[model samples]
Target chain A: MPDLPIILAGVINGLLAGGIYVLVAVGLTLIYGVLHIINFAHGSLLMLAMYAVFFLFKPPVGIDPYLALPIVTGGAFIFGYLVYRWLIGRFNHGRDENILLITLGLSIVIDNAALMFFTGDIQTIDVPYAGRMVELGAAFLPVPKIISFFAALLLCGALGLYMARSDTGKAIRALAKERQGARLVGIDVDKLFAVSYGIGIACLGAAACLLMPTFYVSPTSGHAFVLIAFTTVVLGGMGSFAGAAVGGFIIGITESLGGLLLGEQLGQIGISLIFILILLLRPSGLFGGKG
Target chain B: MSRGTLALCAAGLLAAILYPLVVRGLAGAGVGVSANYLINVGMLVFFVAFIGQSWNIAGGFAGQTSFGHVVFFGTGAYCSTILHVTHGWNPWLAWPVATAAGALVGWAIGALAFRAGLKGSYFALITLAFAEVFRILANSVEFTRGGLGMLIKADQRPENFQFRDPMWIYYLALALCVVSLAIAWQLTRGRFGARLVAIRENEDAARALGIDVYTEKVKVLALSGAMCAAGGTFYAQKYLYIDPSIAFGVDKSVEMLLVSMVGGAGTVFGPLVGSLVLTAINEGTRSLASVVPALKNVQPLSLIVYGAMLILIVARLPDGLMGLFGRRKSGKRHDA
Candidate 1:
């Protein structure tokens, strides 16, 4: 049997993977909380940001993926803002299924467009830390993962503070909690909704920037993370930011440990089985029960 | 039956049977020389229409928009292919068995989801999760050949479901489409169907009105899933191949959704209309590319068009093409 330290490292690495899921789930939760629309295209949008980082890392626009974070995230914020203003706004009073259908459609378009423009080829952004690992006692942590882990926590804290203090953030919370009450108080509900949507997307953008250093960006790669994100969101309890973070870590650890036990292929099966079980056991999810 | 509906159904049947014959006649006369292409496209149109019709029963009538419908399709394909290739059973003989397997899966899924009380987007997401899990299993398992793909010998034997001419397959698919359309028409044109529509319109009201909402949804899902499996078996028979991706890909689920939504979600003729439109759009783009060199490489243009179409349908035409006639109000309820 392997030493306890190796198992400890696996658990740690799983938690590391969970950090990215945390970022993704929090964004999805935030959007669902405010917009009452599940953004099925969230993963695809994140893929676009990944491509942005890939391109920004090369040629005359050369910059490190980390360095391009502010630009890509800011760009995503603006893009998301436009999406809210134009695309989603059209369905303000539409049926719940409309959002589902439109987002499914958006995913199809974005994924196919990427395939057309980028030609289905995998694009990797190589960082110097690709091969670097940090040793701790008898365990090891990859440099890229470490960077992403910290970045995710940092963004989570920032988001937490923003929601707690910022006027726009408070407006969003108010709008989510009591739309009529907020409106009576002269809150620009629509504008606040758009801002919340943009913030949700910006959170995704940060995760994408962090993910680019370690993962290959492809039109189809987002499919995996999309499932993972849904799993995390569901487990964390829908529309709960803190739950999303915790749920992310749980899924991460579950997937990682399951992978270690079952040899990767069957590992995913076990992990998914657990996900279904969780759903069955707690229809409301593991944390907050609200939508 | 209403005169208009009767006439429309009769006209549709005539067109379906005659369309292939006309194309074959054109081929015999050596005119246009693209009759074969037309026939193939017609097959796909019918194939998708049948599958989409299955989707309509569960998603449209029952109002349980499943995003993992390809699960049944994959089940049927794998069941039939495995029975035929490994057990040496005739492919045609294997189809009914595969279809039964598919129905069983549908029942199991319905049991789990409905019993668990998953509704709306939650139901859809759980279905998607199930499909993904199955996809991974299919890709990993040894008997499935694990992403290497499966192929049946092309040996021309009618007994083994092999055909010298592709037209036979096309006709078979068309027959399946007609049968499925007929089934859909029968189901949706009754008091039971009205109950389904009511359930979709408002689940709580349906229950309050003494409708067995759970039983109706499950039954509809089983029927839909079984029919979808039949389409899958036909696909395997026609192509004589099965791969994990081809069988259970999310693309297939979306294809069904697009066809149902594009035509009209709760309308009888909507899926067929959606199928025709999608076929024409894809074919139109491909044909246009043959003439325009610049457009040749942008194969995804059609998909982008589809995406835009989805958005347009949801945003503008919630009732799809049926809304154009102003015959009925939108079945989907507006969100506050």
Candidate 2:
């Protein structure tokens, strides 16, 4: 057994990791809710945001990567909106397989394009605060990761509040819950879809910016996080926003505890296995409303 | 079978058997051809076709769309390699055990996933998770040799499945391709095949019609896994090595899906055509890279092409390449 301090550190690590997972999974759940299509390219979008932040902070511009979050988020939002309008809008409503195939294609294109542009060498932002550590009485935590954790929680809260309070957010939620009914009430389905996609992409972009300080970015970097994101989303419930957030934390904690108890390699697999078990036991997820 | 169907089958069989000989003769006659390269490419095409067909059973016919079919491939490779290397068992004898293991694993996954009512994207995620777990397990286990991977023993006799001749390996792969294709054709044409299509089209309706959806799905998954496992066993033997990265990799699973989609998922001959085209593209790209120094950094170009093709095919030709020429008349005829 590990010491008490070590266990505490593991719990904290899990919470922080869960925060990042929520950032990615929430976007995924949002897209699924409106479009009824699981955007397979969602991870690639995160990778693109990371690259954007990386370039924005490169030598000449010299803007701090963390400071460039707004630009990255905005750019990703526009890109996501355009993608939905031009590419996703063409598919028939119930043809979910077509959406899956198309998004997969887009992911491949984005990943390869990044490969061509950035090459395969892994790149990371060398933020000043990235290496800094905060020492507690018996535990140490990386500063950037702590910052990322808070940022995730704050953003999620803001997004949740916005959805609950804002008129546009209400419209979007109505659109998700009942498209036909929303349309009968005169909500613009197309416009709502585009906005929802933009929001999703913006969420991913913010996550990428937050993650930039702590993780390496590469052409195939999105692939590493994408599967985990998918697992989190599924564990949270296919299209449930609150479920996604809760699911992210659950997965994050599982990964942390698994790493502490098992080896590092097994930790990832253990998290995935736990996701599978949860899926088998409760396909809708812990917080997911019954479909 | 119809006369046209028999003719097509005969032509395909002749082409498969004679292709190697024709290529060998061309090389012998001092044509601008490399027999070794041809054989290697042929082996890849055969294996790709075999695995693609295997995946098609569940993905295309049943519409489950698993992204982790490589789990079976990896299991088969590991099982056969362990038996051969550790126990000194014959490769031919080890194949059944490998296939059985794959079937068992597939059945377990299908039973759990299907019973829980996971469908579509969720099912895909579950399968992908399973593949990752297998890869991680294979990577961490000492007996599997971890990251260093496993290599066939040098100075071993040819009968031990380590052959000095690429021709022998080519023939074995080719035979497996034929067997796989035959099985796919048979499975897709029978009552079980009809039941699969029914489930794919509408599970609720199929269940209303008294179809045992759960049992059928598991059976299809198990059968597909067994076929993929057979391919893996041959792949391990021919490569004279096995590794978690190569065997259980996500790329392999994507390749299988791409081949089926490109060639036309529900069609019997789709896998063979898709495999040949994609393998040729892959080999050609690699060759071009070697010849052109400037193109050396195009690491994932092939995957990009595959992804693009998948999107285009699904969007434009949902019926796949076979739909371009003509629909499979049998399916329509039977319906009528």
Candidate 3:
């Protein structure tokens, strides 16, 4: 076995990675909850956020990554709102596969567009905080990742509170629990759905900010991450906010600890194994009950 | 099937078979574009059609929309190639091995997912997860040569599934496509096919009616897995290349799904129509690239066009191109 310090460090990093998954998965679950459409392009939205962050951090703008979070989140919300209004709204009444196909197509478009425009080269913001590290007694954690983990936790908590407490949040929850019931309650479900999608994407934007400091952005990078996010969301049970938060951290720790136990390659396989088993043993996920 | 529809299918089959001869002649006459069209477009049309058709067995007929058929496709490709390249096994003999391997993997996936009671998008996502895992494994493992991939040299003869003529590959794919279409046709017309379709329409109702939904799903999933692996085998042989990306790429999965969906899911003829349209668009854009020369720099133009077409097909042509060929009532009756 490895040293205790190294294991703790792995767990910390895993938690950070899992934090990102939680945020992204929450968006995915949110969309599925209210809109009842699995947004396949949720990762693409995250990719877009990463790119937006990168552009904003470039020489012309030179904004700090943390400072750019609100801008990216707000922009992503509007972007998602328009996506629903223009593209997804057209197929709302069709079979679930139609939305699935459209989102898959949209992902292809955005990913390829990024490929052409960004030239498929990995992009990252050269933030000064990247080099900074904080000693946590047992092991040192990178400043950016540590910051990102806390930020992710804070955002997830805030979103959870909003969903649990706010009027629109309750409306969104109500819609997820029973669409027709929410509709009968004089809730403008369509508008709420669009806003929910926006918020979902907004979460992804926030995730991108959390990740841009520690992760490389690429056209195809989002695909793998999307799979992990799906696993996370599914693990937490789709539409379950609390489940997603807990599931994210569980998956995160699973990945990092698995990596520590096995090599990085086999560790990924371990994550997939856990995902498959979780899917099989508890399809409703860790915090979810059957619908 | 109706006499008219049967005739249309027969006529389409004849056209497909005779197509190579015409292209051969055209190429001989130095109408050189026919050469590219024959090999690239024609081969891919048949190849993708076969895949879409195989996928249709489970996805269309049984209402199991698997988003990750490429795992089995890649498995077949890798199985055959690895058997041939590493073990010095004859490629022709490797077909059964690959097919069995594909079916085994498919059965495992189906049994697990079905046993878990995964439905709709979750089922699809699980399959995709499996494929990604396979891709990653293929990328990491030394036996598969990792991401650098493995190539079969030209020195191997027909026994090894290599041929000097490019048209042989096209014909092989075409023959496979024809046989698959025949199989799909017969199956769709039979009681087993009806059971599959019944499952597609309503699983709970079918279960209540004493249809063994689980077994039927796993069986078709395995059968289609074998069929798709056959396509993968041809892909590896004809391309003389096998890689994790080429074998298990999400694009390949999307291509399979799109072709079936665009052709007409749950219909035997749908994939044929869909693949032809998709191949035509692909070749059309490709030829345009050569003509404009500048279009080559655009790189991902074909993908962009295909993606747009998928969206358009989903939005407008809900039933796919097959909808245009059949009457509304017959199509509806045939589907549900």
True contacts kept of each: 0.67, 0.73, 0.47
| DockQ head-to-head 2 vs 3, winner | 2
Interface quality of candidate 3 as DockQ = 0.54
- Real A-B contacts recovered, model 2: 0.73
Model 3 / residue A77 / CA error / Å: 0.4
Best by DockQ: 1
What shift in Å separates residue A245 of candidate 2 from its native position after superposition? 2.2
Which candidate comes out best when scored by TM-score? Answer: 1
Candidate order, TM-score descending: 1, 2, 3
* Candidate 3 local lDDT, B1-336, one digit each (tens): 779877977897788778878877888988755575567578888889999998888887777888899999999999999998899989999988999998998899999999888876778878888988898899889899987999877665766688777677778888899888887877767888888878777789999999999998898899999999988888898889989999988888988988887788777778888888877777677677679976664666667766776687778776677767647422232321
Give the alpha carbon lDDT tens digit for every residue of B1-336 in model 1.
579878977897788778878987987987876776888898899899899989988888778999999999999998888888877888889989988888888888888888888778878887887877888788889887878867887878778887777677788888888888777677666787888888888889999999998888888888888999988888888888889889888999999988988888877777888999999889888888899998776778888888888888878886778768656643443332
Q: Looking at model 3, what is the TM-score of chain A?
A: 0.95
User: Ten consecutive residues with minimal summed lDDT in candidate 3 chain A?
Assistant: A89-98
Ranking 1 against 2 by TM-score, winner = 1
lDDT by residue for model 2 (B100-131), tens: 98899889999989988887777887888899
Cα lDDT, all candidates: 0.84, 0.84, 0.83
Q: Candidate 2: where is the Cα deviation over 4 Å?
A: B155-158, B329-336
